[model samples]
Target: MLLLTLYIIGITAEAMTGALSAGRKQMDTFGVIIIACVTALGGGSVRDVLLGSYPLTWVAHPEYMVITSVAAVVTIAIAPVFRYLRKLFLMLDAVGLVTFAIIATQKTLDLGHGIIIASIMAVVTGVFGGVLRDILCNDVPLVFRKEIYGSIALMVALLYHSLTTLLHVPMDYAVIITLVAGVLVRIAAIGFKLDMPQFKYNSPEH
Candidate 1:
């Protein structure tokens, strides 16, 4: 139940940030909502499809989509407020990243999958939604280039796995620890300007 609450918060926060991106591009209202929904839900949808996990689905639960769309519209009304809140939104995205990672880890483990699969799903859930949002906005995907981004997802997944599988910690405690630790790691990366050297290559023209 705690995890569920966190999931809702994560999606709402992500939707609002997504709306900011749409506003930057001056997209129409419908485009804002669409990008917001994709930013909020696309990661989980991709994870489910990849893992063949049904039942926990956006298609089945339209309510989540409705909530995200509403959040996006709300953001549009208050876009100016966020203009001075770049750091806040970045932190919110950090929260969303951890929430998505924890949820994906839980779902994969619940499906009787192994830790490795859980780790992959964690990355997919934590990163892909923003990737979709960036694609829609014609921006470079952050997961592919951002500082310590995907690394944080992997760290959260590992922490969750260690707590539940190795240390035998309770789920609630594990979730709380992972969430706090993951977000902090992300914020610290930003504060320190930590970034991977991005991949770069060019082939000779044929």
Candidate 2:
């Protein structure tokens, strides 16, 4: 139940971000809705396909789509206030990322998969939706940037897996710990401008 609630919040937050991206590109309402839905659900869909999990979340529960669509429309309605809420949006996005990672890790484990695969799927589910959103918006994918986005996802996955699988922590406690830690790390990274070292390559002119 906890995971389900967080999952809904994550998807709604993600949809708002996607709607913002679409608005930046001056897309129409229909386009905004499409991008929002894709960004909110694309990662999980990809993960399920890769893991061979039948009946995707949105497929199993169409209400999720309705929720995402409503969130997107609300985003569009309140687009003007976004400038003041940039930090808030980032915080929400971080929450979404961590929640997605924890949920994906749990899902993979429940599917009888090992921790390594769970970690991988967690990263995928945390970032792939944003990747698709960026591609659609013609912006650079954030995971490729020198930020701690994907790293946070992997960290959340590993921590959750360790707490539950190795240390035998209860699911609720593990989820709470992982979510708080991941969100703090992500916000700190953003606030401090901490990122992985860039790999710069220069070619000499012949």
Candidate 3:
């Protein structure tokens, strides 16, 4: 039950970010709703499809879509407030990332999958929605950038794996640790400007 609630919160936060992205692109109401849904639910849908988990969450639970759509519209109504809450949005996004990662890890493991597949699901759930949002907004995909986005997902997955599988820790404890650590590490990365190495080629300019 708690996991389900966290999942909803994660998607809602993601949807708000998506709504902001759509506003930045000056998209219409329909476009904003579409982008919001894609950003909030796209990652989980992708994960389920890849894993052959039928009956997508939004399909099984239409309320989630409604939530995303409403969030998008509300964001449009108060768009200016977001400009002052950029840091708050980042923090929410970080929490959502951890929530998605933790839920993905738990669900995949519950399905009798191995750690590797769980890790992949973690990354898929953590980053794919933002990737879709960026692509739809005609911006560079954040996961492909020189940031610790994918690393955070992997770290959460690894921590979950180690705690539950190896260390024999309880699910609640593992989740708490992973969620708190993931958010802190993400915030630290943001604050310290920590990033992965980027590739630069001296090719001729077009």
**Clashing residue pairs in candidate 1 (N, C-alpha, C atoms within 3 angstroms):** none
Alpha-carbon shift of residue 74 in model 3 (angstroms): 0.7
Q: Against the true structure, candidate 2 has what lDDT?
A: 0.91
Q: lDDT per residue, candidate 3, 1-206, as tens digits?
A: 66677778888889998988888898999999999999999998999999888898899999999999999999999888888998888888888888889888888898889999999999998888889889989999877772587899999999988998899998888888888999999999988999887888998998
Number of clashes in model 2?
0
Worst 10 residues of 2 by lDDT: 141-150
Q: What would the TM-scores of all predictions be? A: 0.93, 0.95, 0.93
lDDT of 1 by residue, 1-206 (tens): 99888888889999998888898999999999999999999999999989988865678888999999999999988877887888877887888889899889888999999999999899988888889999999998866676366788889999999999899999999999998899888888888888877777798878
Candidate 2 to truth, TM? 0.95
Between candidates 1 and 2, the TM-score winner: 2
Counted clashes in each candidate structure: 0, 0, 0
Task: For candidate 1, give the lDDT.
Answer: 0.88
Candidates' C-alpha lDDT: 0.88, 0.91, 0.88
Candidate 3 local lDDT, residue 30:
97
Best by lDDT: 2
